[model samples]
Target: MKKLLILLLLPLSLFASLNIAVTYPYIGALTKEIGGEHVDVEVLAKGNWDPHFVVPRPSLITKVRNADALIMNGAQLEIGWLPPLIRRAGNNKVTPNASSFLNLAQHIELINKPNSVDRSGGDIHPDGNPHFHLNPANVITLAEVIKDFLTKLDASNSEIYNTNLLSFKEKWEKKLLEWQTKMESKKGLKVIQFHDNLAYFNKAYGLNNLATIEPLPGIPPSSKHTIELIKLIKEQKPCCILHDVYHSTKTAEFIQEKTGIKIILMPHDISALDSIEDLTSLFDYLTGAMQ
Candidate 1:
């Protein structure tokens, strides 16, 4: 094929370039940062579509099918949509065991793994909490993973990926320190969450998670749970009740009606809301809500 020959004859820098596809905007944004200008990234899902609730669109299918590599957060964060997309992408490069297939959750410690293995027990991730992105430290770990992945897939430019990763990690680490300081100075700031999804973020901010609005992570927030949340809010007197934007506003509205505490809606991912387009904006809006 003429195109294939062109690809081969191109310089290592040119040939090493790739079209990467990611499951969500957050991962895509990070990959773009680490991959730099060498890779063209296509984010499959929009931010508001709860990463767990994505319905693969034709565009996403096309992107995945044509991508040289597919990057994901793993840990079942994509259980709902990714599997179908992978099948649809029809890209052999993304198949497990392929050199270009990278699962970012690799080697990261997971929390809240289920003891049982039955879906009938309610929606559960046997792989544990997939909310690792909420913590900036995990991002640092994953950037290295991406850096390595890119280098392996395109070894000629290994130094570029490595350099970008180091710079990004250094920048992110400094920001993390400042955020930790902000959280520590505002100590004893407890809060109740709509679900356990915000655990890592709460931990990062040093906020005390007194309780959750849902008894179980995947279980829908119920009347009984809200009653419990109201009591907990009364007892802890948290300045805010943090809820992801994808959650039911009615439940939050009801809670606000009974308890006069402010309910803060934060994006759980880069694309969680329309205006919260990128990582910096997402962090800025979320950090602002905490303030």
Candidate 2:
């Protein structure tokens, strides 16, 4: 009877999956891709919402409380909302100091580090721009980081994680080549944006970001800024306004009426739009949007 009981419990231990809580849809997607059958991912935020502003809800607390590990975009992207969730959940495993906690920003070299900290700058990220994942090359780096993180946490399935990482890297490298070829002709294309969220993407594809609709980050468009932008647009003659889906297009539309510039809605993460179902589709839409 004792031998039969031991045999029954052995498979359960081998097949158990780690429940990982990720702060955003993209992280959740990446974790699932690498974790495969060995991990269960719980995404805390919706992709369509602004990554800077998430409403910490009771349900998110429960998810964090139950997670075996937690992953975040870091670099202060979640500064507004995530800290509250972590405090409320009281999950040591998900705390920043814990071994189970993973801050993706720590692994990647962040860009746009501010020279000084001030609320007058309109919600600047002290560490840097947290949207490093927008660059496809950084995506590969993130995959490697996640692979090592998983291996460290669950050595029992290290081989499986390694295999998954290799497969992802091979496929992504091919996609990178394809994206580069598609964007080759669009190099040095001048464009406007509602916000500077696409800094990494523009840098990756060599798109020149002329200016933003807003006067500053996290600030709304003003009539003074709008008139100035109109003048700049007529002078600079940018291709279009690459607007984010969450913000209202009223300002961009007004600019279009005055300047006859185009407006293109850009999705920042997986499921950010209905068409963006996964990582591949997200980039596919983004790279194809110029046409």
Candidate 3:
């Protein structure tokens, strides 16, 4: 009877799932879409907040402690927030060099890398721009990487992960075509932004970003810089100012009043607003915002 019980339990052990942790809502969504029933995702940051300034609260430490694996956007995007949580989690599986820890930045090519690194540059990523996910094409690449990571951590569910990926790819590609069609006419249009957070998005759609409101990355706006921006906007005649949801629009508004330009609120992640609840909605709102 004892021997029979052990044999019966063996199959259940083989099919056990993993508990995964992700740094951002977008990563959490992709992991769920790829891992399907084989994984549970714990997202650490709120979607509406600034990605650069995620508060590493105590609760996040507990989430990391209990996770079987961790995936992050990397490229130093998490440098300001995630390290402390990982150190406090005391989970070896989520360590930087562990097989269970996956960094998505390594799998894709990063743009906007600086020739030199310094604090004077204002919160620059030494590796390149960390916001690569803003590009719809990069989202497909990230999904594939997540699928492989899940399979490696739980080989028994490899087939399930693969199947889920195929379905996701089919749906995502169709969405990409829709977005591409919508953005086709907006090419070469000039715009201003609070920060260069949408660097990848601008590149993908052939939109020319004339300048940013911030004097430098992570630096607050200065009166001198704002005055210069007013002059530039008057001379260049950009269509509008693409402002992010997190930062106060006071500066952008001032520019708008001076130049008679429009200010469009762009959400950077899922739930950045009530309407943007998923990856599709995030891009949909973005592509449609310019219009």
- Give RMSD (Å) of candidate 2 vs. truth: 1.6
- What is the lDDT, from 0 to 100, of the residue 95 in candidate 3? 98
Return the candidate ranking by lDDT, descending.
2, 3, 1
lDDT of 2 at 203: 92
How many clashes show up per model?
Answer: 1, 0, 0
Give the Cα lDDT of each candidate.
0.80, 0.92, 0.92
Q: Could you give the C-alpha RMSD of every candidate to the true structure, in order shown?
A: 2.7, 1.6, 1.6
Q: Write the per-residue lDDT of candidate 2 for residues 224-250, one digit (tens) a residue.
A: 999999999999999999999899999
lDDT digits (tens) for residues 1-291 of candidate 3: 999999999888867768999999999999999997778899999899998888989999999999999999999889988999999999999999999999999998999887777866675567888999999999999999999998888887889899999999999999999999999999999999998889999999999999899976778999999999999999999999998899999999988889999999999999989999899999999999977
Q: Across residues 1-291, which tens digit of lDDT does each residue of candidate 1 receive? A: 999987777766564568998888888888889888789998888888777778888887898998999888888888888888888778899876788888887768887787876777566466888888887777788778888888888777788998898898888888777777656666668887877777777777677888777667777887887888888778878887788888787887788888898888878887687788777677667766787
Instruction: Tell me which residue pairs clash in candidate 2.
Output: none
Model 3 steric clash pairs: none
Off by over 4 Å in 3: 1-15
